[model samples]
Target: MSPARLIGLLAALLVAVAGLGYLASLTLLAPAEIDVSQQQAYVAAPVPAEAAAPVAPAGEPVGVPVVDAGWLATNAEASGVPEPALRAYATAQLRVDKSCSLGWTTLAGIGWVESQHGTIGDRVLQADGHSSSRILGPALDGSGSFAAIPATPESTMWHGNDRWDHAVGPMQFIPTTWDIWGSDGDGDGVSDPNDLDDAAYAAARYLCADGHDLTTGQGWADAIFSYNHAQTYVDAVHSAATAYAERTSR
Candidate 1:
């Protein structure tokens, strides 16, 4: 399907199930700017990535001063971030020209919370930022916990489950969330969920929606909260991000 139709479907679904208020932060880029694939919400993990790891996408600045690959490798355990993934965050931060400059550490923090930088329990991140094992969340079962989003297999050809939809990629975004916020971070035609570079960049865009500057306390808190609605999730991400910033971004 065309990118416009995909976006319209995503926005319309969210408005129908979640409410119009929840649509406030969904980014609305032109069809040309947005990724043009209905399958973009969850790029299948089975497809092998391009052998050469992705660099910064074309036409973006690569002038970020955040921690480099050497630093991440040296302090791997301390930051719990791998070199290539760290580099992706740094490059995305440098390239994204927004009022609320996203730092590499913030991505690291969220990465830590989401999937341990795609190293969850021995699943390692490959050069292309695709995790060895695709991490996913259980059905949003609504049980008064996560906002119940009906299984989207009917709408999404990406995730094939019939009874429930799983959150794809290292970042654990539901199909709806991925549909509305996903983007092609790697310059590849597809906005893959399993690719760390792709996932990290999409996440940066999502958090900074509405020009949210994450450098300040409230802004930091708000952005994290937007990523996940829970206060505990925000606190955990903030703590990790702060630790990373104190040592890296500063």
Candidate 2:
């Protein structure tokens, strides 16, 4: 071949190789985004009334983390929850109710709605399952947008207020509720609501209380409404939980 023709052929080969490399890089760098509505339609179809599954009695505390790291990592990526928070939610299930009807996704929904898994307001959820900073809500002194809640004797210890009670920690539990349902989930023997592990376990126990069955739509709605009376809150939790379940199903 002529020198010019040979040079042109070499240039064409180089261009083709570069094009292939660009395509491969695109494939590796940008994965296909998850189709949430499609996944929910398929994987999270509404349960029939007759198909409601009963929750079993809560098991004794296992006193250990029960979720596999591999599973936690996979779900954390898929559901947009940090691995530490995901582990807390999953382990809370094993610690309290191992019911097939309720999964970690429900607790995760609450965590996300309440405090974004303790990362709300730019705070971080530490590796030890505690928030980098305290996550406290406004005082419930029966003032604007809040109901009146007189401070309990130990309220100041948790929320730094002796005049009025505030919702404390990642789960946003008021002092009275915390007194009844607080738990120690990390095996550290302290039931601190700021700790994700303990807070998650407390939430699970509260939701699963009195043999609540979460498989059916009505039952699940009731459980969430008990957490927060607002219908919008229940709907938001349902939406988040359904999305998480759909994402992790892949």
Candidate 3:
């Protein structure tokens, strides 16, 4: 009814609106929650000695380790790895040098880091063990963040680039490395780096090379470091592997 009364009411309404705005800002600006259950330093898991029969003769098709489908499905769901990619990693553990003690989780860890099990960037790992689309890394022309690697005659075929070599496939194998580690994992007779099955098998063999026993801390770290040639990469893979292992262990 009075000017002073009207002014007092307006001031109270403005203060109330400012308080609501501050509360809304706090709600909108709050950081998202992060899961940190497996954030500790990497630890090696116990690996059992070879208890299965000897691998098939060199000339014969290598026998894939018989894995339970349900087990693969369960672990895949837990670790966010596709069923086919998870199968490739699990089978690789036994198909590789049995003495190396490589765990499936380690392979899954590398797959997660390299390309999220070949499903990164709108790419899906098909049931036939191939990525829906070809995944290639930046050119290694010794530019800002990449090593200067000239394309070799053979390297051009895998990546289709004549000037500079790029890492190809889900595992991101460079031309040089793929030449040494490429393998046929799906019994298709062709060793293709773009195929998740073949890439995973190749990665396993590379990690198991040089008599590295992946069950030991030093051995595991060295194997991962050799794959990426970076301590940071090794650490990330280790952390991913550790998380996968912990998730599937339960």
Candidate 4:
């Protein structure tokens, strides 16, 4: 072969090898441009404490503390019973009413158990004057009294006056019972069951009159029994009162 022809063949072969090497490099190498934003998005964000924690329902029992005599006394002192009528009643009762504090405490407990500390729906009379409804209006007796209407027929477990056909107010006292025994428990110049203080005081009066003593186990039990003859009723009131006392003390 001629020398020029041999050199031309070698150049062609070298060019072909170079082109193959370039093609292999292109096939083996990866692109440098990456989408870091998508990767970051894939990594979930941190959740807030509120979002992470389980939430409790409204008016549901959380943690109820134990209520003792000392706690009751402290609560009585702290409770704002400033009305002259209320103060007078408290003073008079304190002189001879040994279980006044206990009565108040138990009443508070009963209120909590009965109405979840008055957070339940408002009580109002029905248009018929004999019946009562929780949501509907036109209060009977023309007293503009805010009574607790039965949320359901089952709510009658507390106090349902078959005669009046309605559940009563703050303390869940039946209208019939209110008629017979309801008085200004707090001496706040009001005998309405919607008034928390009055209802608490009234409950105390009823329990005390029924021979319950907060200072003694028997008395407490008896008083609770008087409120409702059921053992479950007594247990619930006692438990709730004890819990409330403990929580308030804290």
Better structure of 1 and 2 per TM-score: 2
Can you write out model 2's per-residue Cα lDDT over 76-171, one digit (the tens) per residue?
Answer: 897799999987887776656445345677788788888889998889999999888998887787765567778867988998888988888988
Candidate 1 lDDT: 0.59
> Ten-residue segment with the worst summed lDDT in candidate 3?
39-48
lDDT of 4 by residue, 4-51 (tens): 555445433332232233222222222122121210000111222221
lDDT of 3 by residue, 1-250 (tens): 7665554444333322322332222212222222222211221112224222333335566544545556667668976779999888876765776567677777877887788888878788999788888988877877665677788889998888999888889888887777666687766667788988888888887776667756567777888887766676776776677666655655
lDDT of 2: 0.68
* Candidate order, TM-score descending: 3, 2, 1, 4
Task: Please give the distance, in angstroms, between residue 200's alpha carbon in candidate 3 and its true position after superposition.
Answer: 0.8
Where is model 1 more than 4 Å wrong at Cα? Answer: 1-78, 154-157
lDDT of 3 at 113: 78
Clashes of each: 0, 2, 1, 7
The lDDT of each candidate is 0.59, 0.68, 0.68, 0.40
Residue 164 alpha-carbon offset, candidate 4, angstroms = 4.4
In model 2, where is the ten-residue run with the lowest total lDDT?
38-47
- Considering TM-score, which of the candidate structures 1 and 4 is the better prediction for this target? 1
| Residue 183, model 3, lDDT | 81
- As for TM-score, the candidate ahead, 1 or 3, is 3
Between candidates 2 and 4, which one is better according to lDDT?
2
* CA deviation > 4 Å runs, candidate 3: 1-61
